[model samples]
Target: MKTILLHVSLVLCAVSSLQSRTWTEAQTGRKLEADFVKVQGDAVVVRAANGSTMQLPLARLSEADQTFVKEQAETATKPATTAAKTEEKSSGKEDAKKALIGTWDGYMADSDGSRHGDIRLVITEEKITASNPRGGQEMGAGTYKISGKRIDATGTEGQFRGKKYEGIFDLDSKTLKWCSANDNPNSSRPTQMQTNPQAGQFLMVLEKK
Candidate 1:
């Protein structure tokens, strides 16, 4: 959990770096060069070039800086609201339970982008039926839960039965990318869409069928 949090923090910092700019104090007109982190309550969090983070009250910033901070905050939140509404509408429900209920055809690829094997999946509200093909021999059965872009699944059949997996996924109307790591003994969930089979991470690119 801490790893995930740290990864997210790093990503946010990188984004802030790209948006680094000058901020002016309203009363003294003192200018500070910093990267905008986030707006907390009535204050804005910023990171200096020296890697120090500090919070300044919105009232202390110039009008233009305050406007910039509010705009940044709104821009950050709009996509989440839009995505939630889109998913709810597409699933024809208030949640994501049925959003992934369908047949998917894809191949598992190794770190070097070599296809290991072709696979098919039939997903329902809570269960996943995996196989080599649409009607070929069954590979495994599992139960999964989705929270935003993260998927938590546990195998319930075959050799992998009782094994837990954690992954991140990007799903749309046509394509889905599922990248995961086995969480049996010790493995961290993937933070990006890449695979390292030697490290127990895998990537699957699938298309709805």
Candidate 2:
């Protein structure tokens, strides 16, 4: 983390001061008085007083210089840290439950955009049920758990037995969506519904009734 900050500081300094300045690298017992040009990756870019560019490793910098880099990094990340906390508070499990513990209705479509059937969803305190008006197959009964903005369900019986589902709640927490292909045993949690002809569609969305 400190190393990244050191590089960022060097880049900022490069644009602010082109004049040669002295810096002592205590770790290497080296002294340099050069123009700060930029920093790229793990190296600081500088121009020697003789006008030749040089790349120096941040690990060789003095303890004080490294400290300064550390401070800059903490300052830059503070806002992001605060925003993350705010999001967490607003999207906690209790909050997600409020938006999800109810019934919903939607349609299931194939990757070819063909309508599969009209589906009814029933979400309870600890379980979810899906009723397919067309197939008459019981494939949507499962126990569920909610965390943050995610809903995870595991099958109770039938074809869906032992299968797991992972899905996201919309920002408004009104729409639930997940990949149809993710209902496999130990399969990776899907990012979107399958799109390839064999894989089918990208996702399924069910809205509140």
Cα RMSD (angstroms) for every candidate in the order listed: 15.4, 12.8
Poorest 10 consecutive residues of model 1 by lDDT?
6-15
Q: What is the C-alpha lDDT of each candidate?
A: 0.77, 0.63
Residue lDDT tens for model 2, 20-112: 556678756778888766555666677987789988776777766556545544555577689999888766766666667787776765676
List pairs with backbone clashes in candidate 1. none
Q: Against the correct fold, how does model 1 do in TM-score? A: 0.53
In model 1, which regions exceed 4 Å deviation?
1-95
